[model samples]
Target: MTSPSELPSTPAPTTEFEIFRGLHYRDQPLVLPNAWDFASAALLATEGFPAIGTTSLGVAAAAGLADGAGVTETETLAMARRLAGLPVPVTVDIEGGFHEIPSAVADFVKQLAACGIVGVNLEDGRAGSALAAPDHQAELITAIKNRTPEVFVNARVDTYWLSLDHSSTHDRVRRYAAAGADGIFVPGLTDRTGIEQIVAATDLPVNVLYSATGPTVATLAELGVRRVSTGSLLYRAALSAAVDVARAVLQDAPVSSGIVTYPDIQRLLPAR
Candidate 1:
């Protein structure tokens, strides 16, 4: 795999608006693998993920902070800077902007843009509110575009996740699109009918959260989804695997001998 430094340093989309549009027409759905930190981001980039996203849950957990609480802004930005040096594009999950003011959120995005991030996921699950008022969230989205138009604004609407009325999802998506969002993310939506309705109703690309029970990738493609995100699934899976491994060791259960050799692991380390 090519080193991030070896990749061309194309200037990010000149405007956030352009970045949002560019992500939609790609030949296939953007299969984004969310990473927790530098090593994960680097390995995923090396594995040829054209774009990588930061998982807020993963980041916050690593820092011993609560996810979506606005406590990891500095940590998130630091990770973005490191990822910026990688070959593929990096889009971060900025949980609710860590602040209510749109300008504060926009300021945070400007720092990310300066670090070479091409996109970000700004969700609308307001702290404590069932959902941030559509108009209020739209204001934040518009402010971000106005401040840093080159960063792809993935405006996430968590209506379904918050157990709010599903009917409001479409209206919120439309409002986000009008607010200069490049893509719309509906994470808790899984059913075929609901997915189709959202896709049919929105002009922007619809990003769906991949669920084991939801339609398969092929089905999502057929239904017009332009992006599929794993969200915290990978992070959770890693935790589960670790716990299982620990239990096996404690119980003296036979373990697979096909693990990577120390030499192989050493090969991945940067030069001393």
Candidate 2:
């Protein structure tokens, strides 16, 4: 693991972004585990995930705010600060830059760059609309990259998630890459053909959100995907497991097996 202190001094933003990009497509594609808070990020870092990411859904849900509603800017910033203190590279999901205006969004990326974050996932869900106008979102991406060239901008197009009537995922990716996006992320992309198309269409590295129905790491790598993000899956699974355990205890049913022991969790916790 590369410690923050050991990283080159005065590193260019593009340099840092390339380093993270290089982690992808290596022996194994970079499997990014998303965390909502400091402890979770630190725990994953301690467990040897070379990099950690923030989940917008988990961050918003923990604060009782609506996810993808642009309500967690401050919370995300604070979380970035906390995660930066960890030993590994930190990437944050600044959902849609928490604002529509390009300058406002660009300023937000600048703030994140100052917080020692090497990368950010900027989505184009467009608040209440299905997906932001491709041109409008591309403007935002270009503004962010021009302002903070070193920050890896993982431009996320949520056409699949929003169930939009888009015929060309390749076209969408091309627009973002022309706008200077470092990488392209297509969440809710589970089909092999679609994944392969996007991976081949763009020169930028492709990031796919991990789904139970989606291709496995080896398969995604085989198809030329560079990064696989867990997104909100881990957090959602943890919630589901908690509910299942509680229900079993109340009904006098047997607890699930493979529960991590308290001692194991203790060892995972940061030393006091």
Candidate 3:
């Protein structure tokens, strides 16, 4: 594995945005690992990921707030600021842009871009299995693009995620693309037919949330998925592993040897 010291420092904002955008066009889908904090982001970058994204669930849970409730705006921004010095470009998941007004959402995104975030995942899913209207969501995308065109806007259609309107996926994908979205993310879409259909729906790069039970990375690449995000999986797995290790210690059983060493983790961050 390449050490963090061997990797290049953060690139200029415009170049970084271009690099993040170009990752989606590679032969293999960009296997994005969502990081909840600086250590996770820095570690993933040291391992040579092209880019890193923040998981709303991980960030919100870590901050003791609820995900997708528009309650994590400040926490998300703080996370972005902390990640500004990483070796790879970073994207933030700003749930519903943290506001109802399009202009307000744009203003918030402007702040995120200013923190060296190259992209953002703006979902349309609301609380209680509801979804924002397609037109209104498109307006939000437009406002964000108009405010910060260099920042890659990954418009997230939560039809499958929220289970609200399955048939509207194609329409929403096209709408967001027309509204100047740099990519389309449809989480909870697993089947091949559905994946192919969404890929064919728009020319914009398609992103899907990685699922253990879903098709493999090669399969998704064949289906034309440009990006696959492991959203919250790492954070959740870390939590589970910590609990299992604690139980083993209590029982005087051998703990897992695959754990990262304290010194290794300490080396992940440089002196500030």
Q: Rank the candidates by lDDT, best first.
A: 3, 2, 1
lDDT measured at residue 114 in model 2 versus the true structure, 0 to 100: 91
Q: What lDDT is reached at residue 120 by model 1? A: 89
User: Lowest-scoring 10 consecutive residues by lDDT in candidate 1?
Assistant: 14-23
Candidate 3 minimal-lDDT segment of 10 residues: 10-19
Question: For each candidate, what is the lDDT?
Answer: 0.86, 0.86, 0.93
Q: TM-scores of the models, in the given order?
A: 0.88, 0.88, 0.94
| Per-residue lDDT of candidate 1, residues 1-272 (tens digit) | 99998999967766434554566677678788899987777767777777789899999999898887778998999888878877667899998888789999999999999988889899998666468889999999999999998888999999997888678888999999999998999998999999999999988889999999999888999999999999998888878877888889999998656654577555545675
Global Cα RMSD, each model: 6.5, 5.7, 6.5
Clashes of 2: 2
lDDT of 2: 0.86
Deviation from truth (RMSD, Å), model 1: 6.5
TM-score: model 2 vs. ground truth: 0.88
**What ranges in model 3 sit over 4 Å off?**
1-14
lDDT of 3 by residue, 204-243 (tens): 9999999999999999999999999999899999899999
